[model samples]
Target chain A: MPLLDVDYMLGLVPILLRYLPLTLQMAAVGMALALVLACGLAVIRVLRIPGLNAATLLFISFFRGTPLLVQLFLFYYGLPQLLAFLTQINGITATIMGLTLHFSAYMAESIRAAIVGVDRSQTEAALSIGMTNGQLMRRIVLPQATRVAVPTLMNYFIDMIKATSLAFTLGVTELMGATQKEAAGSFLYFEAFITVAIFYWLIVELLAWVQRRLETRLNEAYRR
Target chain B: MIKVEGLIKRFGGQAVLDGIDLAIEQGEIVVIIGPSGTGKSTLLRCLNFLERPDAGRLTIGDLNVDVTRATRADILTARRRTAFVFQNYALFANKTALQNIAEGLIVVNRWPKERAHARAREILERIGLADKADAYPASLSGGQQQRVGIGRAMAAQAEVILFDEPTSSLDPEWVEEVLGLMKRLAAERQTMLVVTHEMSFARDVADRVIFMEGGRIVEQGPPDQLFRAPQDPRTRDFLRQVLATQVALDVPD
Candidate 1:
């Protein structure tokens, strides 16, 4: 059992730092797509329209019940076999597709909870004041729901950052993939893994700090 | 001006409002009083289409609001002219008091933000909450939140405002402030329909007082007549019980 080599770990810092932007990009892109899809799904669920709502519920339940890694593999491998169109899609798109679907399902539930958390009487009040359904949702319900949902949604993004490590399984050379390649070439697994871990820690801490600031600002009106 | 004919509302086979008929004239303040679970609040809510009537004809001004037969557009038109205030002061918790007041004006009436804010400020001032305009409902006291609710209704320029136990959730000291505001509104000839347990406030401000029991209007008339000489035995019993409770509280230890 060799003692931990601080010098070797320090030397790998620059190499891992080079891959930082790629990791952040994957997380950022996945989150943006998930947010848009989640918003549509949440609105559908809240409105509870015929046929469309049932379909969305099935989509959400399926994505949420399964494992994200399995979903990623299915999108990257299984879907291409069934659909000739998806065969032409690149690995990055496949990974992003998997990440978006998996996260959007969870995000939809969080948003729906926030929407439901609003007082039922508020909707009645809005209707009594002559607001149409669309007007009520757009002007009253969603703006308030979004504020409540923001902190929870940010937590999902942080989780998605770590989740992007699974993208390496799809042949996308993101942060984790790059680290594996470096580890194999240098035969220094511990150093390479430690360097990547530190990079992720830094990014997660920064995001968590931002989330706190945002929650505070959103709740400024209620603060004494 | 409102007419309700054969109004019937049921929840899961339990009849809440069964075959109620009433006519209210312009510039009249009608206070509805009833025991819990007697459908007084539901009756006020149905007048504004907040709760759709299961069976009946509700005509506010010229629009019909019977869910069984009315067109969607007609129902929406009727709702615009009638606003409802909830017992819990259902002010939008996330918005400031001013934003709550301005929401209907900007969203429903399509007023510009500047114009809506100006009107909201004026209405808040009228409600005696000008100093707390920018505060959120969660930050305000229960009475202040109810005042914001009143201001929100006023800003919508509703022809008729419905109140469901507006002071039920307020403190004893705070109750007078809100009832005072309602009294001032009544004095200015604002058309209002209120469901309340405060017999004194109803007697003081309402043009007509209607007592309900078991989903029917048991007695209705001018406040002095109804309170002094309630025609029905049920009304007399209710008044006697309420007065007994007050008298028991007033006795020294």
Candidate 2:
């Protein structure tokens, strides 16, 4: 056999592309779940809700400091034994849950900083205008903070799509899982991995383009 | 009428405002002039419970709140009767100049969006910023932004408007524009408590003037009396120190 199998790599591309949807699904669902949870966690962290901030801090520290691979294995293998209801969790569900939990910890910090970055004067101005607390948060504060958070959130989303490759560890046949089988059948490891890498690169480029446009729109008001 | 009594605020154990008491009649324009750190701004803030006085009583129109025992409802009710203009032109930076003025109406007054925008546009015209309706605060000059800020307070239409050094942050070229707007509001007999350093504006526009020092009202009287024949030694010293500059402006080179 030749040292390099160019034909095998080209053939692996279609097979891996078939698995791209599954990988995209894991990332999209996990990111949607993480976004909601992160926003709540960020608000709680920003407000310093009495008696809960310590718990939140410890939770963030644990998730942020630990390796995601370790967390994924723990959630996929160790969790079902600890919780009876978790026994029904499948490989895909476990992988998504792991991704959501891990990514939310990181995103929460970015969101908290974005919220706190909103100027105090904005709060005072909204309140002085007789806006209720709800109105102030929904209308004045969040919109401004969201603009500041968009680039970071997009970075997290792109990170997540790549992270879904780890789902193979949980037995989910996403892009990486399919690539592993193709590599085994043909013993063309380099070709299999390159095919998957190209797919990821394309996805990242698409998302980065959207991020650039969004940043431009967000900055339009302040632009001279 | 707006009645404030026994207001006190402590910061790191020192009282910023100690035992402030004053009354302003309906449509009265009271200008508060004092040295920095003397609590003139703090007193105006206490009226709207912005600084949350450690102990005080504030009555704005029919709403009353005791600082020590006030409920959340009581606080909001008191806040609704009053409005504030900030020293640094705290317009909503994310919004267009017109939206900044309309925010209060849409949120607090529950006006329909179209109606609030219509009213905001009229206020923009009234403030001589009709062309800036669609411009965000960052795009506007300091004078244009400050005028939009004043229009926000005007749209609030509260029984009393508390100004916290509204013109102190402006460039010298822009100060006259903001002060001229306030002078017009004064002529309309809007109830206002203005904390400012523009002594000429105080001398010319105030219905009553209050001099504060060391967090106490040293003296208060009609502008003519407070400016020309202040009774308290602190008041006389303050006016002399501040107006010595005005005296120079009055005399042509």
Candidate 3:
């Protein structure tokens, strides 16, 4: 193998950093959308609201069971051919939609597990205290469930940041897309790809560090 | 005041609460005692519609609680009148003790946050947990958590509070702390329907003692009358067995 090119890798840093904002925006937008969808799906499954619950379960199962790459292609490529409306959507929007759907399925399962993890007795206690179903979920159940979900949700976010790399396949000029262009022009695939890998690793590490800090803070009151 | 008539509950094929009838006067403290699995807890849960009775007529101070017959809104209104404390001290684990106590007041009563927090603090102090107000349920000992549970119930200011084996899960040494708080609450003339295994506390704190067996009320009377001289054979046998076990455990080798 060619001697590890430190100078070349160092030079690629500024180039990759230019696309960092785009990468962060995709992850942030995807996460916000996924959170909204996940909360709805989780509540449906947790409460088992008849037809809605069945639909949510199917949504979760279908998305989670299939590979995310296929889902991305289906949204970016397959859907536009099938429907004219989707053809009007841009690559960035399609990438975000794909990321949101894929992440929301995993997030729904995580959130449902967290919600179910709360003791049944707490719900009963809330009800006996005269809380309506809405009040119980809003004031009691979700507050507790969100605490339990923080770590898992952060894990999903970290996974989401890595998953954004696949958006390059849709021709969205995110960090990975920028890296591929830079590598193709410069003919330094190894150096360019390694720089992007390092960037992703650093962000994931930062998120993992924040996750640990959050977990400790949330659990601090309970610890002696 | 409450009236329960023809209360029946079944889990699958097993009858948990066979048709039972009882009347509780306003400001009365009624202690229901029976062997485990005799549906004592079930009966208390039924009062708040936590475990809806399969067949029954429940009237809490003139409001009917047979959910099947009552409108959804009406049932909710009736449930607000009665608060329940569980064996496990079901304080929301993620919430501070104060938040747990203030939640019902804020959500159900629409009390402002400041007023709710103030009232919650007062109740926590009354329950001897003022210093632990900001602590989470997981931070407190079992006894402290149960006290917080009592405080949560008191904060709701419901007309009646139901306790289902409140101290049964406490450490033996710490049981009295919870029972003591309960005794004080009973003395304050809080309308309490308590299901407990602590015969001593029942005898001391209850206005009336009820013995349940096979899901039916077999006997009831003043605590002194029931404990000193139970009329039914089942009650006598139960008291005898409970006392004999305590005695055997206490006696030296």
Report chain A TM-scores, every model.
Answer: 0.92, 0.96, 0.94
Q: Candidate 1's residue-wise lDDT over A1-224, tens digit each?
A: 56666777787777767867777888889999999999889878888978989999999999999999889888888988999998887777877888899999999999989999877887887888888988888877887887899999999999999998998888878789988998898888887888888888998999999999898888886676
User: How many backbone collisions does model 3 have?
Assistant: 0
What is the clash count for each candidate, in the order shown?
Answer: 0, 0, 0
Task: Give candidate 2 misplaced runs (Cα > 4 Å).
Answer: A1-10, B248-253
Chain B TM-score, one value per candidate, order as shown: 0.94, 0.95, 0.94
Question: Which candidate number would show the highest lDDT if scored against the true structure?
Answer: 2
Worst 10 residues of 2 chain B by lDDT: B244-253
Best by TM-score: 2
Superior candidate under DockQ, 2 versus 3: 2
Q: What lDDT does each candidate get?
A: 0.86, 0.88, 0.87
Better of 1 and 3 by TM-score: 3
**Pairs with steric clashes in candidate 3:** none
Better of 2 and 3 by TM-score: 2
- Model 1 TM-score? 0.92
lDDT of predicted model 3? 0.87
Candidate 2, residues B1-253: lDDT per residue as tens digits?
Answer: 9998898988888998989999999999999998899999888777776777899888888877788788777767767778888888988878899999998898889999999999999999999999989999999888888899889999988889899998889998999999999999999999999999988888889999988999988889888777767777777777777778765333111
